[model samples]
Target: MTDKAVSTIAELARDFGVTARTIRFYEAEGMISPERQGSQRLYHPRDRVRLKLILRGKRLGFSLAEIREIIDLYDSAPGERGQLDFFLDMIEKRRVDLEQKRRDIDLTLSELAEVERNCRNRLSELAKGREQA
Candidate 1:
């Protein structure tokens, strides 16, 4: 099978639904490296895949540093079992954190609903009192 040899900034941005500035920011952060052809930045297939990973990581709430670490691990020695183990540990931690956040949000929404109900009941009582007066 053949692969895409190169990609332009505009093409990738359009395909990924992100702005060119966002892709440039990732380049600045050392997430992806693209070759410069005069004033144009030409992204290789590797860069394109890296960008995909970076965007996916960002969407999953990973920090740039965390994403970089994971990407670096992917490029490290193939026999490094410890790196894979570390990545697994990181995934578990992230899962736990996200689950806790979900629980907190649910609790917050429940509290808000209760507060709204109380406020509505108070307003209804106030309206009844005014009518009786």
Candidate 2:
């Protein structure tokens, strides 16, 4: 392997910013195919790149299955059109979901503000009652 490639599990994990267990999990999931050198896992440059993409996908809220599908598509066809289309679809769906979540959060915040106001008003009223008493 070249100098840029990872030759051991520790090197792969360090380069990818993941745990060794994560690499093993990805291997078990068939998301990556690393070579075995005397019971030690050796990752090449391609595996390193794939691991990066997988972690990025996870951070972007993509399921493992979805990440695998996207990665497979990219690996199978080294072009932009299909990937762009898929990304556009995913982005639109995520946008709509986020909009709905924003609306829900806004409503919850408004409700919380009302509750806080009411609690403060009640406390003030009770203080006034004690003063009068």
Candidate 3:
């Protein structure tokens, strides 16, 4: 869409593959402010961009408050540099957390496999003993 192109909340939701309620939640949270056209919410290109950023942040495990802080810096005195630095820090933290979670999951899977193997072995031993008896 063009820089000046505007869209309705329904259009934005459809394009973003999100529910209208989700958009409304973001709106209520002061994330995206659409134009009010006699009860209809008309979203402009700027709001659309913000919504995209918000969704991207959510996917990256950032909270709405964090996303808002980053987006606010875009037009604030801190400018692009501050936003980038903050986002990078968030990315690093999230990466570390995710790596720890991966390790935990791997360890759990390994434990499960060992338990299964032991159960299979016990069953096999019982079957052989029954056959001999």
Candidate 4:
């Protein structure tokens, strides 16, 4: 099969709407390996896809270490099934964490609304007192 097209680091960064520094940081973190053309870095299409997944994983609250673990699993020698199982475990854990966060946020919003109502009532009472005076 013919090799896929590769792009310069700058091109990849522009395509992904991320900074070159961010891509380099991922490389430093062992998240991706780009080909080097002298001092310049070239990224294959596979690297581009990996970068996309890395960014998406970050947005989903995955830490760099966690993302690296997941990425490594896919690249592991034993098999993809083991990695798939590990990913499923991670997904389950994240679901629980997200549910807790949702509950906490709901509670916080309710408290905030109560505080706002109290403040409005107090202000209304103060305004009435001033009007009477």
Residue-level lDDT tens digits of model 4 in 1-133:
2245998888888888899999999999878899998999989877887898799889888888887888788777655787778878888998899999999999999999999999999999999999999
Candidate 3 shows a clash count of 0
Worst 10 residues of 3 by lDDT: 1-10
Which candidate gets the maximum lDDT versus the true structure? 3
Which candidate's TM-score is highest? 3
Backbone clashes, each candidate: 0, 0, 0, 0
TM-score of each: 0.83, 0.87, 0.92, 0.85
Report the CA-based lDDT of candidate 2 relative to the real structure. Answer: 0.83
Ranking by TM-score: 3, 2, 4, 1
Please give the range of 10 consecutive residues that has the lowest summed lDDT in model 4. 1-10
> Better model by TM-score, 1 or 2?
2
lDDT (Cα) of model 4: 0.86
Q: Which structure is stronger by lDDT: 2 or 4?
A: 4
